[model samples]
Target chain A: MTTPPTTVPSTDIEVRGLTKSFGGFLAVDDLSFRVEPGRITGFLGPNGSGKTTTLRMLLGLIRPTAGQGLIGGRRYAELPAPLTTVGAALEATNFHPGRSGRDHLRVLAGTHGIPDSRVDAMLELVGIPAAARKRAGGYSMGMRQRLGLAAALLGDPRVLILDEPSNGLDPEGIRWLRGLLRHLAGEGRTILVSSHLLGEVEQTVDDVVIIANGHLVRQGTIEQLHGDPATLVRAADPAHLAEALHGQGITAEPATEHGPGALRALTGDMVRIGDVALVAGVAVHELRPLRTDLERLFLELTEAPAHRNRNLTGDATPSTSTEEQA
Target chain B: MTALIRTELRKYATTRLAWGMALAMFLLGAIFSGGFGALYVYGSLTPDGTPVSEVVPPLVLARLVYTAGIQVAYLLALIIGVLSIGQEFRHKTISGTFLATPRRGRVVAAKVVALVVVGALNGVVHLLGCLLGGGVLLALSDLPVFPEPAELGRTLLLVLLVLALWALIGFGVGVLIPNQVAALSIAVAAAWIVEPLLGFGLTFLDGAEWLAKYFPSQATTATLDLFTGVDPEFARTLGGAEDPLAWWTAALVLLGYAAVMTVVGWLLTRSRDIA
Candidate 1:
């Protein structure tokens, strides 16, 4: 807040050690990240992982217990014209059911002195015009989200913050929304969208800030997470194989259901892991080169180790080879 | 600020709930004024031994029927205020509102000023209702059917003042109590149950009779009483014993309640996070 907008106009959003707490429990703990201009940065987390809380703080809906959430380097309260500078749809149902979609946007536009023409344009932009005259209560979940987005865009703001924007959207609606976000970012408008799963936004967002248990667990470009392909192999003694592979300076992750019933290691070359397994006298029941999918990588990075263990072991069998052998 | 007011006005106009509540207010005013005002005021006697049936000094009939209209106007104003302001919180639209108008204080001011206009609308409709009710009953009684324009205008001005204040009170209550249903319930219960009970209970409490004059509803009535005396039965329900305060004094007291609530509510909104 001490910094002026002039200092960070290109950096649309900045969260520096932002923390929030209820009376006893901390909801968001020391989270920090910057949303660069002209990119869709996914704010990914679990249901209670503080994505919404952080977005709320950034929009000035909730006060941060520590640090700051700044837009254009100014606190939201200090943004002389917040509506025109930042348009945020924090939730899908933040509207009156009694009002029409058009009326809803018009009332909001009135607050910022936005013209009526823009309301109509936004209605067309969000593609809810057919339902624009109907009461919002009658809107389907996808329609409500479209209206929410329409309301956010009323001011033609430079930055858009959407929390769980695709919650109730069908695949088609979600595809339409992805196109919208990509188009907005293409025009150099910064967009920050939150979802509980990275796959939900991996195609839409260029960068990612991932959180878990109210803390930043991982963050980087989608390429950074997905570029490093790995290897999957099932061994008769999986834990022994994991330790033996670790001796060669390769980190082995416990296997997920998609893995070939073995430890999954982050590496593109299959020969190195095969050489280590051969040295350790472990039986390689299955071995295959693997590409890291964003969703599995997200789960590996965010879920609790114990939970990840259950996740890695519950469906992981001895080996498909063992079943074939039987 | 003008845009905000327009937005609030539009919000009320577009919502079916607002129109429905307002229509109810208008009908209530009409029935109370025409049906009940006829039974209570048409044949009553004035302070100087003049019959309300007399056509001269239209004050006798104007006062009789306008007083009934004032009570109905209060209820209507309260309803308008609650619906106008309460729904923002009820529907969790306060976030949208604050987002659009980041200066929370301005939203408070806009809400108050907008409700004042709605309050005036309530006044006009209630007046029409009273004319319908009282005019019908007076005609039935063989008294003068209506007051002259000058007398009619004054009664309307008084009723408008009362209704506008009640609306502001409703807006203040809406801000202070964030729950829409709770704020509205308290508003109705205060006017219908709490004020009447307190006024009735304090009537025989020798030293505390003066406390009733300070009640918001009573203060509004007391100010109105300056132009015309209230019913002895109605007055007694409000801790009735003495003449009302000077017209201006009662006006100031009633206004003080509205000013305090509005200003206090504004301060709270300023400090608290909307979430």
Candidate 2:
């Protein structure tokens, strides 16, 4: 037999026209995205926007109804040893209650022929050595999540697919996890971290693949997607400011109302907002470009009525390519 | 495969349920053997109230071994089966299990092998307990000491067969029902109530004798036949079949049930989403 491919050199994950359905409902519809190696890739979406489904399909836990998800250049199931290729924490706490935390790791390690010494090392790595001997049934949700992480790290996997890893963590724990993911990515590991909370992923992830209602909405580096200052503007007397800007053929909507006269504007041109304010003889108290946060960017990209309607009425038909959506 | 099996055994061996089942088997065996030995000793006395030949200690020990092997030891096998598979789903540990070993078929196979090992260990423990308990009782009651090697060997073999069946049945229930309490309840109820009741009701029917022999408990009796030194008549009565199945035939039938159940469970496990 030919030797199996050991390393996925590109560290790039490319998914094309991946679709999955449950009964008659489309969970993921023509989803296409990529996660480049050496950077944290945030799989961002709303609560039911198919983020978890896409991740599960990527891990080969649930087969895609149509299309393909590739880690490197091959599907996840085709990998010789998946544990060593990809480490995942899909659900924070899926463990046998009767087993101690250390024993749980030991059993999982045995699957890939990993030794018991590695199990102890992982327990220490996740900082749960004290509770390692205690039965998993009595562990708190956070402790179980840690143990799950320890198991994921067993094979020294290059790709990490985590779903809401910070769900039940304290502030310190969340900080620790963020740092850990960053450290892993720094080692050239491809990390696909999913979270509905954009604020949490904003600083952690370097790139993003945003989905809404099971469809790809926006995907790029964090700087490219959210760092563009050309579309946002802030000013005083925002209502009059918007009206004057519209008169000048420059559309400006309310970003957020701050005080009596202060308001933020989400427009196609920040430069145009300043010019329109000057031409309309309106005093500009605060004329700065609005920095787009992930949450705001996500809402703007996904809240379009046309997109929402398409998602709601679309049939559960699977698509073979991303172009099918177009 | 050995590693997987060993891991599964470790998982079940550490549980309180395993300990409780073993304790129950030892106690039940001791009580039954002690009671029978006492009665036998009393009945052996002459009309003058002087004792003649006494019941052998090893014989009473063998009886205890047989009863516990059939009843208590077998029950532990069922418990092992249910806990092995059912606990994974019941405690939501299946996700971890699947994540670790994505090949679902291998995991199911490991559980079966583990079940067999557990059954064997329980049988050995029960036998030792019987021998020791019987020896103590005989010494206390001043009974004859005759430990027949053939009888002991037979009793041990019967215990192994019965325990194997119990584990197979328990595993089937665990895989089909995914809930520990529900699986245990169903296995216990079927062994105690449903099969026994159906067997009794079938005895009144004509031409159903052969069919009744296929019932789980009846099949267990047939499997247990390898252990006893009793005559063919005694074996026939215990099985309660007009034409009882051969020991090997009973083993095959039980194996067939286990094989089918395991395959079906594997299929379900493979196809269903772990969510």
Best model per DockQ: 1
Summarize candidate 1's per-residue lDDT along B3-63 as a digit string, tens digits: 8999888877778866676676667777766755554444444445444335334555555
Model 1, A139-206: lDDT tens digits are 88899899999888887778989989998999999999998888777767889999988878988988
Report the Cα lDDT for residue A175, model 1. Answer: 95
Chain A TM-score for each of the predictions: 0.75, 0.76
Q: Scored by CA lDDT, what does every candidate get?
A: 0.76, 0.72
Model 2 pairs in collision: B154-B227
Q: What ranges in model 1 sit over 4 Å off?
A: A1-11, A231-289, A305-326, B41-57, B139-142, B145-148, B226-241
Best by lDDT: 1
Model 1 pairs in collision: B34-B133, B34-B134
Model 1's DockQ score: 0.63
lDDT of 1: 0.76
Candidate 2 lDDT by residue in tens digits, A168-197: 888898888888887777777889989987
| Residue A160 displacement in candidate 2 (angstroms) | 0.7
